[model samples]
Target: MNCEHAKGLLPALLDTALPADETREIETHVAACEHCTRELAALRKAAHLVKELPEIEPPPFFAKKIMAEVRAASVPKLSLLKRILFPLHIKLPLEALAAVLVAVIAIQIYRTVGPESLRPSDMDPPRAPEKAQSREVAAKKVEIEVGPYQSRTPVVSEAERPQARDEQMRAAVDKAGPRRAPVSKDSDKKGFAAPPPAKKAPPAPDELSKTSLVLEKKAKQSDVETPRASAGAGAAGFEGPRYKKPEEEKASKPRELHSDEIGFTESPPPAPARTVEAERPAPRKLEAAPAEPAPPPPAGLARETGADMALDRPWLDESKKAGAEEKAEAEERPRAKSAFSAPAASAPPQVVTVRVDERPRAGEKLLELLPSVGARLTRKQVRFDRDVYFVEIASKNLVALVGKLKELGTVGKASVDTAGDETVIELRVEILGRPQ
Candidate 1:
């Protein structure tokens, strides 16, 4: 064997894989050729060194890492189309689902806007000869009745005729229950016409006398039965018609006043005398105090005039008393204070503008320090620009409050412009931060 063939068989000879004849030929070549001998010797030394080395276990997942690297290197660069359609295991199932979705969509589309043949319209069958004959007979009857007018009027079906429409309206009204009475032409004219003059015959003299006697008797009974009340009440708690005695009736005379004397104060109709009181029982005394008595009339006026004054104007005394009381109240009411007078002390709120790196953190710190320094937070305002906290603290504790707040953030100088009587100070702590 040549040196080239011997070199090729050297590794197989080292592993004892070569046949005896080949091994003998390779060894014979190696012995003759210096180059093959050196190559064989070097290979033997490497094999011996490998066998003498300690057997060390490979790292965890060594085989998996190597196989992954081999696979990555073996894979060819994919075109954009191939890359998009990669991962056949998952993509194939997705493609199948897409196909099914498309089929379902196609079915939905077909159902919504399908061809006309899929759903044909129903056509009526031809009428029977007997029915056609009956229709012709009906048409002939219409023609006989409306022969002359039919040319001028539009053709109307039986259902659309005025008589038929009126019948239908009546039927619908009957079905729904009548809402109102149907008004006819005669009734409409009668509704607008003036009614016949009511002929009320004058009552007979006998009936007139009887009615007057009944009314007088009822008036007398009510007057006697009802108790006498305040002066505001008419006569004896009887405001109805008052029957006069025989003397009053004879005394009452109807005197006409001329137009020239219209303004002249005529003597008030003489009050009916208390003859009814003589017939009535004495009235019981009322529990309520009597209303203020009307002022006594002058000596020139008769006693009857005093009764007239009380009956005519009982409200005079009440109105006068109310006016007097109102006048006294007006005099006693305190006058409003002048503008110059120093009113109650109320100090304006002092704003303490505080600049801080973090507003929320500073606010938390301020909240924690408020109670320790004897200050109470009245209101907390969170706005877009800044956070404001209203604090009410005693004037004595203001210094301590400020000192404690300085630890949280930079505190601004606040002027203490409090009123002399103001003991509490309202401090507005405005915490500011850098703009976002």
Candidate 2:
């Protein structure tokens, strides 16, 4: 074997893909040649030396530091509890409720046991503190105490009559000096100031009458408690619950002047008697006569007024004219047709035709085969020119590849041409690729 052949086979010989004959020949050449023998020996020794090279060991702390840093920088493992519950909507309300419950309880406890602070000394004794003062104040308040109204009838002995007289009342009335007008008490037939009429008397108590007399007894009960009350601001209770604010007395007032929305007061004169322009009597419009199949008016006048009768009647007139014309033409057509007769009875019909030539085409089925052969030969892009297709490939022997493609079915004949600068093949194809 030649040195070049032997050298080329050396790698394959080592890989064992070479045929036995080639391997044997290469082995014989290497054995006979001393230079090749020495080269092979050197290659073996180099490979052995590479295999024997020592493994490197980094510094002891290198791995430890790297591992520590990696661990420190690594993402933490998510808590399974959080992972399981985070995205669920159900847990949100539960967690919110729990948090709210805790907050409410905490607030309640705080309010229940919060510090007891003293209020300002100037404020009324805290919380109805002065029971005595409060009772006094309350007692002074004008309260209409309702007792269990016990109903009863009064009895009087008829003999006690003439005691009721204006003179008897005048003495009592005058005695009670120019004080407040006192409602007089009632008197019986015997009068004698009728025991200051029982709690309540029917038949209208004789108050301020000739038969009645008002008592002069003077009693100072609660100063605030008075039978007659004045509609003044002083009556509203003071020192009520902290939440009850003092009453606000807004005196109702009557507005006297008109004001604009902007708060500017303008004494505007009454809108000048609106001489409402007597609505110009909506210009009377001339009414047209109603239509009841009336004969159409002259075209000129109707057209001037754009009357539908004149415009519409023409269509009917045109239809009637067309009918008359059609009838006259129809009556004349048969006579006209009868005057013309065919000269012959039978004859072959003449025909005119032009011929066209359509070239046979290679269908998609055959075009697909071109790609397979072209791909096997490492072909890339292919271009078409009329009946010829040019294929660009990476390898030679493209002719042989084209021959293999011819085995596939085709609608037309083809020939491969491989004369080109680069590895290119030309094919006489009738079909080219189509847009998908």
TM for every model, in the order presented, reads 0.21, 0.19
Model 2 lDDT tens row, 115-180:
211111122233122221222121111010110111000000000000111112222344422211
> Global lDDT of each model?
0.40, 0.28
Model 2 lDDT at residue 163: 13
Total clashes in model 1, counting residue pairs 3 or more apart in sequence or in different chains: 0
Best candidate according to lDDT: 1
lDDT of 1 at 216: 43
The C-alpha stretches of model 1 lying farther than 4 A from their native spots are 1-347, 418-422, 434-436
Worst lDDT window (10 residues) for model 1? 280-289
Candidate 1: residue pairs that collide: none
Tell me how candidate 1 scores on lDDT: 0.40
Each prediction's number of clashing residue pairs: 0, 4
